[model samples]
Target: MLASLYKNNHGTIAEYKRIFSSSPAEVWNVLTNNENLKLWMDHLEITDLRKGGNIQFHFHDDLGTVEEITITDFEEGRVLEFEWGKDFVRFEIRPEEEGTQLLLKQVLTEITDHTPKDLAGWHVCLFHFADVVNNEKNHYPENEWEKWYEKYREIMK
Candidate 1:
């Protein structure tokens, strides 16, 4: 699904929602566990899992800057949010009859030249995340990522 972008007090909020047939606990595991998290978003790891805890965002290509982002909000299986550079990244989980509903929101302080690329990467990650939750191998779809990048560019413009 495409992310919806809107202005907020701080900046813009780009939110993406997904539904999974996996239970909330199952989905939560995919989002929080270090092993499962690496499968979806390789650059990120949760060093701690509570408010004021930290998450490491590594730049594999850059290798020089490893950001230990502070957790701004957290709940065992319901919510996890943290600083992402100058912005914030949040994941909210809720139980559904079949499985769980997950909302991933990235708070953007500005729509810079990199904004579209960042949003596209997120759209791709969530796409791969759904597959991993279903026990499939992690696959980054380059075509889909390109498509999303163009969509985000048009939206930002």
Candidate 2:
């Protein structure tokens, strides 16, 4: 599903929610574990899994750019929040009666030409994340993302 974008004191927030038919612990492991993370979001690597630690963001381009994103908040098996460029991205996991609820929020200080693209990217990534939680092979659906990007562009307008 597409993330809902709203205004907040911090600026804007893009909130995405997913329900997985897996235990919270299981989902948490897939979310944080480097090996599991590689299956979905290979660009991110948790260099230090703690608040005030770092999460490395890699851009596999000719320049091999890597950014050290600081972990602003962390709660084992519960919450993870980290720096995302000028903004921040947070993940909250909770055990639900059906299984687990994963909440992803991207806090944006300002909306620019790149905002919709980023939102679409996160939407697609979350879909892949669900696949990982379900023990399915991760695959990037570029066509799906393109569809979402158009939707997001309309929404942003």
Candidate 3:
């Protein structure tokens, strides 16, 4: 599903919500564990996991580009918020009666030409997250992202 975009005092916020049939513990494990994380977001790795620690984004290119993002807030099982360039990306997990509810919000300071790409990327990643949580194996859907990117581009315009 497309993330809902809205404005706030800090800036624009792109919010995504997903419900998983997995338990909260299972969902959190997939969200934070490195092995599971790679299945959804191959570029991101948790180098350090505390509030002041870092999450690194590796480009995996010939240049081997890497950027460190600080963990701004963390509560072991419930919340994880970190710096996303100048913005913030946060994940909040709640236990639901039927399963788990995962909420992801990216706080954007300004919408740029690249904003649609980021939003579409996250939208695709969330779909992967659901599959990972359900133990369903599949290849990354590059074509799906292109379709979402176009949708996001139209929305941004």
Model 3 residue runs over 4 Å out of place are none
In order, the Cα lDDT scores of the candidates are 0.90, 0.92, 0.92
TM-score of each: 0.92, 0.95, 0.95
- Weakest 10 consecutive residues of candidate 2 by summed lDDT: 135-144
Encode model 1's per-residue lDDT on 1-157: one tens digit a residue: 7899888798999999999999999999999999999988998988989999999888887556787899999999999999988999999999988889999999998779999989999989987798789988665555777888898999899
- In model 2, where do residues sit more than 4 Å from their true spots? 138-140
RMSDs, each prediction?
A: 1.7, 1.3, 1.2
Clashes in model 2: which pairs?
none
Against the hidden true structure, what lDDT does model 2 obtain? 0.92
Error of model 1, residue 154, in angstroms? 0.7
71-117 per-residue lDDT for model 2 (tens digits): 99999999999999999999999999999999999999989989988
Error of 1 at 148 (Å): 1.4
List clashing residue pairs in candidate 3.
Answer: none
